[model samples]
Target chain A: MVEERMNTDKMWITMGPQHPFSHGLWTLRVHADGEIITDAEPEIGYLHRGWEKECENRTYAKIIPMADRLCYSASMTWSHVFCKVAEEALDIEVPERAQYLRVIADEICRIQSHLMWLAAVGTDLGNLTVFLWALREREFFLDLNIRLCGQRLTTNYPRIGGVRNDMPYYFERDCMRCVERFETVGLPEIMKLATDSSPFVGRMQGIKYLTAKDVANWGVTGPAMRGCGVDYDVRRDDPYDAYGEIDFEVPVLNKNNPKGGDAYDRFLVRLEEMYQSCEIIRQAFQKLQSIPKEAPSRVKVPRCIPAGTHMAKIEDPRGESIMYLVSDGTEKPWRLKVRSPIFVNVSSSKHMVDGVRIADVPAIMAMIDMCLGETDR
Target chain B: MTEEMIQAPSYEDVNKLISEKFGEKVVFRTSTKKNVKAINEKRRIFLSTDRDTILELCTYIHDVLNFEQATSVCAVDYIDRVQIVYHLTNYFTGIVIEITVDLPADDLHIPSVALIWEGANWHERETYELFGVIFDGHPKLERLLTPQSYEFFPFRKSYKLRGSE
Candidate 1:
């Protein structure tokens, strides 16, 4: 007797929407051949809240909170980007001292953001110890953030033309202390735990390789592009804030390093980047200290922005975050468009995860360091 | 090449080239603010070139005028017409070129420049999906970022959330 064969074409596996490691409300429908991902489709909009449409309806000042929700982890970056674009649209000049303070806040946010990325990436790689250590270091910066802005994550601390609040009395000392601690104890421990682990290195070293050409072609930026041998950093290339006046190196892979463009290179690059961010914060703190104790934190501008379009790009921890603001001489902006780095970075996932095993999917996605909130927004 | 051999083309030279080549097909031209002092002479030429002449203009901009990267594509709806703006930037020299096309609101169609720059593929798909502008001869002209079954174009000015429209 011949037995009828059951259908065994393509197996659909649900990955997220409730998974512990998943960043936000996103689901992955994977078509696999044993362990190989033949086709992968991302099902998004589960977390979508019509933020763009909401921005159009709300006043410019009211949109700040919504901007914070764009990338919850790097909330300051979103607020900074929004304020900068609004300032440009309004043609308002930020004070030199205010710019320096903005840099301090921006760098602190970067440190915290990279720490969060490191922790999340570590957690994804099964190195729970690294996650705890990284988060511990991250909390240092978050504490500083809370002290300054009265909130931990969504600190709507930036406003058009300047910051919402002046630097607190303990700002300089606190930032310097954080930097000293990061250099002396925090970063080294993270390096030892993450880089020295055999399984972590083996899991990340040569996996999901993206070339410099691919990086440019896909418009991938930040650490992911830098991981693949691209020397472009928006901070260095397109200077904003006091980044132009400051002295900090844009860390890329050493030319002599054999495995220059891979997951290992990216890990090393971010490791070095944390150090660079520390140096920037220290310099900014010193600058802040040297400035007069009483300087106006906010700039005076007309209520309505000049009738035109303006675009501003800033180097967020994730990548080059761009804000395009269109104002028609109204209290509210005519249009506000955000070119989020994660949106561009995540678009290259199909190219990155083609031949990799199913087990490697999480690691690859983490390397891209996508924030679905930003992407969907 | 010597410094004289690589003489930087003035903004007028670039503007003159577009006018001389495209003539009547060109619609508008304007200059915008740029960052660098060295490229102060640079101008952001906003041209509404013909759909058939897009590849030719893109090639001319790349090979001759030397705009290296296709920076961004912005789609705007103006009630009766949909305007698609291609913001192109010269990588080596920081010159921005804004190429625009206005299609009627009823049947918004333009030729796809995916053949010229592969980066235009996704941007075009996004524009098509959001503004209902069809790119003729696109490889995979389907909805991206938005779900396939999404009935209305969200970016359109007429598109309301639930009850407003």
Candidate 2:
């Protein structure tokens, strides 16, 4: 048997604006001293569509549809944040039932988004089975979204004061079924695949660690923060929509993170969060059943919200998503700013990928759940 | 037995503490009600200050007030002046504090908070290109969203392009 040794040659390597391992159209340029990464600089903006500037030109109603494309996998959450901001800015009220419906839509969106993330993680680690299974499971929720809003990925369901559409006729039954399958069957399988024996675990177990202090400094949030053993979640901390009325535990690094934070811990945090999303959806579904059949789902928004400045934040599946709006005394906005969580998350990569194996970079980046649509916006 | 409940310091209490401590350095402190109701932000306080006191104030915001991170930095052009906002939050206490400072269009420069908040690096760069608010002392202030060679303040109202009036 011949044993090969690592050759410590220094060179710069660029991992795509078009590499399979790269999340989106972002390039990660690495300084590789042999197989170890000495330094890395992440380059983004391949997906920048100037959605914020476009929002400046369009009326508030027009912007909701545009925001749906901001994070296509989790469109409801982005649209919901805008709706709340507009509602608050306009001083409009969303009825109790409408709020509850928004909660249901948002949670369903959360599960689907996380499943897509799970698939991406699996693909990054070269596990095609998990990727296939995760996406297969995601279809149930995607189909449900279509039934409710007439669109799947970019539903554009959330309007200014409330949701645009009501729950479909059999949505109650369909949601319960999807929730049961994802919780009981789909999640357990993913866990087995992730936690069970695989050579990939050695690559992910103790690599690309981010300390709690580093996470706080970089404003990292969502599963990445939870995986680092700092248990803070915006849903519980800053309750929006029907979150105040719901009950769910924010999952953290329940595992012994001797590495402070690891790719596997992020994997576990996301897996556990899926179960919690199921719990929230179940509770919201029960509350949703009691609403009157003919209750109005959306209110009439004025062409322009009263001239004011307001900032709204929500716990996106990725992290803390913020939309700050300043309305002039006109139909169009004076200014609109979107603080993309992934942009900040990706910025921390120049530090994270430092001193890591060049091989481990893909797995490390995957754990952060990079979606360039929002980051580049 | 009923428990003697402990409550975190109220927003007004924090506001008063800030007022007494910072005094006139604060250009204004927003009322606790509107600030709190802004997304049910229980621990956040909004304050505006001038550029001269910004670096000193951000040091106070970081070292004294214990803001863990600056989540976002953006500049809004009001035609007359560009008002930049830094949204800082403390994770442990679940408190968010928004710091605002204005720069006139004629002199659009403010001391960088990037020195305090590492996450402000890309944000400051983006704001520089888009709104032309130079973050003085920012180690590498270049175009983030736009190309490196590009030099237009696209987010500013004055930079009108070919398409629209």
Instruction: Give the best candidate by TM-score.
Output: 2
Alpha-carbon local distance difference test for all models: 0.75, 0.81
Candidate 2, DockQ to 2 decimals? Answer: 0.45
In terms of lDDT, the best-performing candidate is 2
Off by over 4 Å in 1: A1-14, A254-260, B1-50, B59-71, B89-97, B114-120, B161-165
Give candidate 2 misplaced runs (Cα > 4 Å). Answer: A1-9, A254-259, B1-10, B31-41, B161-163
- lDDT per residue for candidate 2 within A1-377, as digits (tens), equals 22256545689999998998887798999999778888888888777777777777787888888888888897999988888777778766687688888888888998999999989888888788889999999999999998999888999888887777788788889889889988888889878987784776776887867777677788777898889877678788777777878988999883344457877788788888889999998998888778887888888878867787777889999999998888887888888899888889889888888998888888888888889899989
Instruction: Supply the DockQ value of model 1.
Output: 0.26
Q: How badly does each model clash, as a count of residue pairs?
A: 0, 0
> DockQ for each candidate?
0.26, 0.45
Model 1 C-alpha lDDT per residue in residues A63-115, reported as the tens digit of each score: 88889989878898898889888876665668778888888888889888888
Fnat (0 to 1) per candidate: 0.06, 0.47
lDDT of 1 at A373: 89
